[model samples]
Target: MAGRALLVFLALTILSSSVLLPKARGNSEGDALNALRRSLTDPDNVLQSWDPNLVNPCTWFHITCNRDNHVTRVDLGNSNLSGHLVPELGKLEHLQYLELYKNNIQGTIPAELGNLKSLISLDLYNNNISGTIPPSLGNLKSLTRLNDNQLHGPIPRVLAGISSLKVV
Candidate 1:
């Protein structure tokens, strides 16, 4: 009976681990998003609902999540926000659209953003952003539109190979 109980305990532990793993990873995404929330200055309180204590960002306004609760879109355009973008933004593994246009945000784009392999549209247009675009952006095979930011410096040569890319 002792051996049987031990086997059951181990099985339960393994089962629980499988369930807990995604929640932990999901929380990391929430943490990453919250990190971004802390970095910006929301003068209009548009991001007022981005409460980090929440179980996940899916409940937050302007943030869209997939069926699995993975964050997919972050729409903060034209909301009178300022401050620089954070590297934690790259941790949104499932993110597709990142729209931060028409804000007063200033500073160099974090090259870590290139880690977003699933990004489709990245519109930082009409912002006060500066600095060279990361060459690692070429890793975003799913990228379709990246345009109209205040970015300077010669475009990375690797982007020329991505046929799906349009507009910059």
Candidate 2:
């Protein structure tokens, strides 16, 4: 009976850890998004649902996650949010779509964004963002859209490496 009880206890421990592991990983992404929320000016309270207290950002409005609870998309386009992009945005390793277009956002783009290896669409068009496009963005092999912003300076030659890039 003692051995059986120990086996059951071990099994329960493993099951509980498996359930909690995803939440812990997801919380890091949640922290990243919350950093962005702090950097922005949400006068419309559109980000009101982005509560950092949640176990994961998956439950937050405008945030999408994959089956693994990893953040995949951030659909905040035209939500009337302004403010500069935070380097913390780069921490979302699984982010695919970062839609923040047509807003009044101002300031230079964060170069740390180059760390997003899985990024596909990064729409920041029609914003007040200014500065040279980071050559590091060339690292995004999956990037497609990166245009219509108020950026200046010569386009990085390194971007030619991205065969998947369509609109820039």
Candidate 3:
């Protein structure tokens, strides 16, 4: 009886952990999105559609996710979102594409964005963003596109040095 009870206890522990793990990961992803929502100043409420309470952001419009349920794309181009880019955006570790073009965003490109090791395309063209191009952006080895809109500064030498650059 003692051995049977021990086996049942172990089984329950394993089951409980298995159930909790996914929820923990989901909560972390949700927390990251919530942080992103807080950082931006949504003046026109364009992002009002992004409600964390309604459902997972993965199912929300303009958001794309991978099979592992990680956010991979955020395509909000030409949506009239006026705000400053926040450094916390770097928290989306799995982000692949970020399209916020043709908006009115104004501010320096956060250096923290370099932390997105999985980032492929980062389009912010036709906006009011200003400041020096961060050299850390070179850390994005996976980056395929890096478009800026009216951004001013001495282009980072690292970017200039990249042999893969098809256009500047």
Displacement of the residue 145 alpha carbon in candidate 2, Å: 0.9
lDDT of 2 by residue, 1-168 (tens): 999999999999999888856653447888899999999999999999999899898888898999988999999998998998999999999999999998999999889999999999999998999999999899899999899988999999988999999998
Query: How would you encode candidate 1's per-residue C-alpha lDDT over 1-168 as one tens digit per residue?
Result: 999999999999999888766654448888998888888998789988988888789999999999999999999999999998999998898999999989988998888888998899888989999998999888889888878877888999988987899898
Global CA lDDT of candidate 3, please?
Answer: 0.78
Task: Estimate, for each residue in 75-164, the C-alpha lDDT of model 3 and write its tens digit.
Answer: 888887777888878878999888988888888889999888888888888889888789988877777777756667677877765544
Candidate 1 or 3, higher TM-score?
Answer: 1
Worst 10 residues of 1 by lDDT: 19-28
Candidate 2, residue 73: the lDDT equals 98
Off by over 4 Å in 1: 1-26
| lDDT (Cα atoms) of all candidates against the true structure | 0.88, 0.92, 0.78
Model 2 scores a C-alpha lDDT of 0.92
Score every model by TM-score. 0.85, 0.85, 0.77
Instruction: Rate residue 168 of model 2 by lDDT.
Output: 86
